[model samples]
Target: MTVTTSPLLAVRALTVRYGAAQALRDVTFDLAPNSALAVLGPNGAGKSTLARALSGLVPPVAGSFALDGRDLTGQSPDTIRRAGLVHLPEGRGVFPTLTVMENLRMATACDRRGRAAAVDRAFEIFPVLRERQRQAAGTLSGGEQQMLSLARALMVDPRLVIADELSLGLAPRMVDVVFESLRRARAAGVAVIMIEQFASRALDFADRCLVLQRGRIAWSGDADRAGPELLRRYLGEATAA
Candidate 1:
């Protein structure tokens, strides 16, 4: 008999409350290595809150989280990142004053290996960053900045990457570029948990999906099996022709 390795990351009965309002209630999920898990939900459905908790940006009110069997329930964001879990936040937090190359270098500096190798990997995924190496990150278009955010995260060589609203505020073509980059990340053995508002596109790239509603998981299943009804229930909208 063969025993499967435990999941790359696990959330057991995780709950987070902001002040008096509960943002998540006993939420649970696991991400296997090299797999992509998409979190789908309508606005105010606790998707962002959940991503925050997973990335150690916000504390959990109850329950536990672990990465590779190591406890991370109350760890700081820096500590979690040092442990190979990286979060590319919703706002594409690139340094405005720094050049694109500078932003990538900053992230690569933190890697265990010398910065040279990490820089190479980042450039390989985003050659455009190399082309625009001297441009200030703030000057780049929305899509370019988003790419920089992802490239920065990859510089860390993370085992798990949590991306919040990866497709937010971009042209459809740019969204495709971002998703393609994410696919490459997944191919390279990184587990990705993405919180996305675009259900159709998220499902396109995700192998498994979890739908959150009112701070709870409404549905969790294979993306292929998750159809219009599941999306409707999560989004609270009827399907359109």
Candidate 2:
């Protein structure tokens, strides 16, 4: 498998706050190209906050994030995105009224010359998207909409893909499809940061794991070494058996 030992992105002493309430505190980690890092934690563990801070959607009050030694701590979302970092946010961040093709075109709008080719690349990943190219995205089922969202992100050809809840509400088969796409992205040398609530699935697919509890990293290490018992210890006893 393609992998890199050097860090592609690094976060240190990261912190985020909403008004007076701190959402994340002193979070730190590193991600490498051609690898998948799973961020696992229960709700309110700051998983989503971490994702938003990385994407520049939410401002971090402390610490820093750097990509290839470039400080991205306070960059605008547009600037961060253009710098080869893409965030596939939860709830399928797609334009509901836009057609499948149109939704994809929006992602490549910054580079109109590459729109056609980008759309073609998207279709290659999810052929159903090609069939529904003319249909409104809102009309598509949950799984198809999620596929469209993933396909659109690929339009940017990002170096790092942060997927927040990639398989939230999909059926087993659809979840498999989304994960397969993620694997393809990883194999293609794209660094992936998966923020998922499904601990078992995330731990199984990721190369490394970071477990969060109360907005702090409870554990961090190789996923292969984090056996079921170890994960359950930090994630609570309710984790899958």
Question: Which candidate leads in TM-score?
Answer: 1
Q: Candidate 2: what lDDT?
A: 0.86
Model 2's number of clashes is 0
**Cα shift from native, residue 173, model 1 (Å):** 1.2
Tens-digit per-residue lDDT, 39-122, candidate 1: 987779898898889889899989998999899998999999988899888887799899998898888665546788888888
Worst ten in a row by lDDT for model 2: 232-241
Query: Each candidate's lDDT (Cα)?
Result: 0.86, 0.86
Estimate, for each residue in 84-125, the C-alpha lDDT of model 2 and write its tens digit. 889998898899999987899889888999888888888876
Spell out the clash pairs found in candidate 2.
none
- Which parts of model 1 are misplaced by more than 4 Å? 1-3, 111-113, 238-241
